[model samples]
Target chain A: MTKTHYFYIGYGLLCLLGITSPLLNPWEGATTVWDRLYLKFYGVSPYGGFSLLSFLFYSIIYTGFLYQFQLFLTDYLSGRFYYTAIRYQSLARWFIHLGWQMSYKAACFLVVLATVTVLIGLALGDSPELTVSVLSNLTVIQLLIQFLLNGWLQLMNGLMIVFITAWVFKEPSYNLIAMGLLTIAALPVLNAGGWLPAGLNSTAYLSGQWEDLILITMKLVVYLLIQLVVIAVLFKRKNIAFY
Target chain B: MKLIEVVNVSKSFKGIQIFNQANAVFEQGNIYGILGPNGSGKSVLFKLICGFIKPDQGDIIIHPSYRSRRADFPQNFGIIIDRPGYAAGLTGFENLKRWAEIRNQIKDEDIKRTMRVVGLDPDARQKMKSYSLGMKQKIAFAQAIMENQQVLILDEPFNAMDVDSVKVLRELLIKYKQEGRTIILTSHNEEDIELLCDQVYQIRSHKLVPVNTMAKV
Candidate 1:
């Protein structure tokens, strides 16, 4: 990957971090509702102590970093494939890469519309009153943009595996298995419900910046681990041409 | 109008002149042969007609009936220049399937029919890596004949073929000619040139001349 591309990804993370600082003090009305929900749900020991916007922002930026890491790493894997194939055509392979990005963004748009509709319905009480203002929901937009940006990057990495199998891979059957792994790794985390835990900021047993760094790093590490295994499994099959 | 016209087309390489000033008219249904020595610009001339390369100072015009525009060189001609290259990782059938999808020519059953015509194993989904040189040549031939093109240009189409395979290609070319399809084939072998060409052109000193009156036998 280019140095300029790496800078862009880092800049995106820094921008998200700046936007998330203001969620430290949410609206009083939003705070009261959260307090009541915490009391009813978890016997009032601050079960839902934080704002929803904070969690959403944290997950969005965290996943964004991992997404850039995946792109850089997969490019290495793809470069290996390109040199090994007897007559690999990058011209044809480009289309497969582009198609994945287009489809990913189209899904992200539908998800954004659905999130806004759900938030609006909950804020209103079947009257024509506009209770929730736009600025408070500003963090929601940040959550979605990061999802889409990272989602496309992950999809590109996934399709790179398919391209390698049909074009550069010496063995044929492993293509199917590698593609299965890619599909699972890139599945959207948005629709997994509360059971899977919120992506970046689930209430852990610890708190503060150190806890945040440890948790975020761990998530990034797991994401990279999955990608490494996928590449290694494909690379070590037999006489890996080392191209 | 002539089906295809080449007016004063010339090309040079470094300081050497290959085709200085050449003109030819090709009519429909003629089996024109390009005959010359090993480095006599036979392949270069074919590339010029296929629009793969450009002449230094002239225009090539295929008749409107032959093709609508110049960018559609691929549509007008079924050609082989230099050598036939295929994606070795893909099976011949898979390679042909992608080609069909690109060209919108020869769907499923048409592919089967073309395979039969060229005597290749349509069911041979084996990666082209396992194919012999002759088998790869046959695959290119099968692709070239897919859409029943009106004009065919082939450069040394039988370079790596065995006796039986050569005979099959000759018969295939003859069948296309019998249907009044304009064809051009270039080769150095006297026998192939004699058997396939109606009129032979010699590239001498960057000029193309019909070989009716050579100075020697």
Candidate 2:
């Protein structure tokens, strides 16, 4: 197996032991799988002043995913990339292929996180039915689907932001801008709306109304499409010099 | 026939000129050598030839064959402008096999023969991370010639290679030239340039100056 496969296994173990273990323990207060998920996402909020430990735990996953992605992206910056890229008919096609790979990685990470959450929740005897205060209109299955879709979108947004930032600055090291953005977005503040870049990932910001959810989802999708165009433009002029 | 031409090409980085109205010609069935001091943009010229980077001014006219293939970069050209990289966890053979799978022009026996040509054990299971620098360079060389590319742009292709391996590669390059392949390389070793190059050029004052005609240009 590749190092990436091992990394996923390690990430799963870390989540099981560090994040979900304490949150889903039977000794914790009245909680269903929905409640556990709610608390988990609640810690992602900038305003609530929720569990600091929980927030840090989830942040590790986010940070780790970004770190892995950064490494993957930089691999193409090496000299060998030119040799491989020339084999392709067009550099744009190669860039698009890389985008698809990045999207696949984002989806895979969400699946890993979801699998770990479900395993922990089931083992601890938490009911799968929805019990969260927010998004009360949706059934358990719908809520879960929304959660996965939202999580995947947020990860894609983050990845694109990092990629665009690096390309704009013409420095691979500029990926730290994403880390800084995450730090500022995580700062405690009142009324942290879903409009905040990082807060969009928080379930606490999700409204009960399906209209709001759809609007937010559409907005994110549009924003991601625009970002894709911007990245392609930047890449068109980017010089692949890595001395 | 002229295979590649750099016509009045000018390039600069961060406002510092690397090349200014430079001109050079590479024809088929010849080994050309470029010599330059550190920071002289030897690699940049190779990158320009391979279409990895654009020249700021003037044109790099590749032969019609590349354009005929509809490839933005030069097709069927083997390049090693910088240190080659591969999956560090995979064996040398496996790494070459993975790269070969991209074009599917070469099979397992071809890969093994290339490895043997470069003085590597094709059956060895040693991962790339464990290979010495010389071994790694051989792997890079093996990959470059494995597909029988007609054009080769190599920068410091013999770096880190031992004497015997270097001699073997030098002979292989001559053999490639005999087979009507065009090869361009940069080397610090005077012997490599003396024994191999059909024509030699040196990077001087942001231009490629023909070594034998240095008094004129």
Top lDDT prediction, candidate number? 2
Per-residue lDDT of model 1, residues B106-131, tens digit only: 67888878877777888876888688
User: Chain B alone, TM-score of each model?
Assistant: 0.92, 0.96
Write the residue-wise lDDT of candidate 2 on B38-121 in tens digits.
889999998888877789998999998855454668778988877877767789999889778778899999999999999999
Q: How much is the lDDT of residue B78 in candidate 1?
A: 71
lDDT of 1: 0.53
Every model: iRMSD: 13.8, 1.8
Model 1 docking grade: incorrect
- For candidate 1 chain A, the 10 contiguous residues with the lowest summed lDDT are A36-45
Model 1 chain B worst lDDT run, 10 consecutive residues: B67-76
Tell me the deviation in Å of residue A14 in model 1: 26
Top candidate by TM-score? 2
Q: How does residue A227 of candidate 2 score in lDDT?
A: 84
Alpha carbon deviation, residue A178, candidate 2 (Å)? 3.0
